[model samples]
Target: MEEVRVKLPFNLAAGETEYRSGVWQGLVLKWQKEHLLLELPAEADSISSAVYGGGMGRLKRAVNQFVSRDYECSNPVRDMEAKLVEWGYPLEGCAGLMTAVPLEHAAVAEEDTGSAGIFCCVTAAAGNAARAGSQRSVLAAYRPGTINIMLAIDGWLSPSAMVNAVMTATEAKAAALADLGISDAENGLPATGTTTDAVVLAVSGSRRYAAEHVYAGTATDLGGAIGRLVYSTVTASLRSVKAAEAERK
Candidate 1:
């Protein structure tokens, strides 16, 4: 069967590439391995489920850098800290996410609506994919596979709206997995996502736009954009990984 390419509403940048969406510009770098660093035009209000700086807070000290690194280590926290030191980045001001999926398989999607813009980047590996709430006789040990999502917006989002966005993004991810027919190995149930999945959301909080989003549910425009961007990005990232695997075989 011929593979149908997923059409993104915006450009999809992959590998070592530089991209700009609205007020944000970022670099997809290849160090010892591939990683992505998105530098905001200014400090932005953000929320994350990352290991470093994994909470809702206003980014300070011009440390508006959001990073997604390809990592494989037993001591993730300590190794991630050392990686920042080796890269000359201060741990105090940056938000970081790690995944075993190589950055080469990373996918990016961007959308601009004149009033607000959204950007999403994803790295996905579903080897340990599982459905939420599945009954397991024994908990599995930590593994290297994960689905990491990094999202950015060029407009303002209320704190509550930020949390809403996270929910929306997560729902979209599960929907993508379902559509792909992914199943949990342990229970044979439809997989919702990998156990180690993580997400980071950042908003520019720019008043340059007249609208300030107070809600990011699926019913809202911001939420709609978030849903489409995340859904498409995750689907595309996973497809790319599958294609790579097929090519290797």
Candidate 2:
């Protein structure tokens, strides 16, 4: 399946709602008394553009502007986490969530033929929408690469710890992107405002596969913890298989 890059809505200021749409479904990135919803068409196949039916060019421009200007520094995780801590999150004990998805899985999706590819199965809804509000403002402070980590945290962690989890993931993801020559982690990543905290990273041209680690808040939060455990276990299993394949080579 083709992996397409998408831009989120850009006008989500304080108290303003932003809406984004795709071909199959819609999403509302709800904020403080605001909505960032995505528009979707009935026929998924009709989507020629990226998320929001917008072209990739527009997406690219938005990315460059958001990351280049807003996220000016090449390294901003430290400052971002500092802000989070100031906001009352005990980030010292925060753990890293890490996992890798192999190209073999992509092949499996292709072979299935009846299913929507692996991208669709594990992908998040997205479109162009800017982050607003104090909570969102904290999120927008980081680069796209780091923001994606936060996005994963929002999915994996409970609402109570979502903010802190995102901070931790942001640190990890920034390190990964820097190692991969992605220039600036802030602008290099791809995200959509399809949901409250849904985002997908742009991993083309550098890595052979995409990795995501969902920090599901804490052990007490069963819902988030289960998400973390399932993803971690599956990824570890895949990594072992991948390592074995490498040894055969």
Name the best candidate (by lDDT): 1
Q: Give the runs in model 1 whose Cα sits over 4 Å from its true position.
A: 1-16, 22-34, 60-74, 137-145
lDDT of 2 by residue, 32-104 (tens): 1111111212111110111122211111111100122243544444543444345443443221111122212
Write down the worst ten-residue block by lDDT for model 2.
Answer: 107-116
Where is model 1 poorest over a 10-residue stretch in terms of lDDT?
A: 1-10
Best by TM-score: 1
Compose the digit string of candidate 1's lDDT tens values, residues 164-229: 999999999999999999999889999999877888887878777789899999998888878888
Candidate 1: residue 151 lDDT (0-100) = 85
lDDT against the true structure, per candidate, is: 0.71, 0.25
State the lDDT at 51 in candidate 2.
Answer: 19
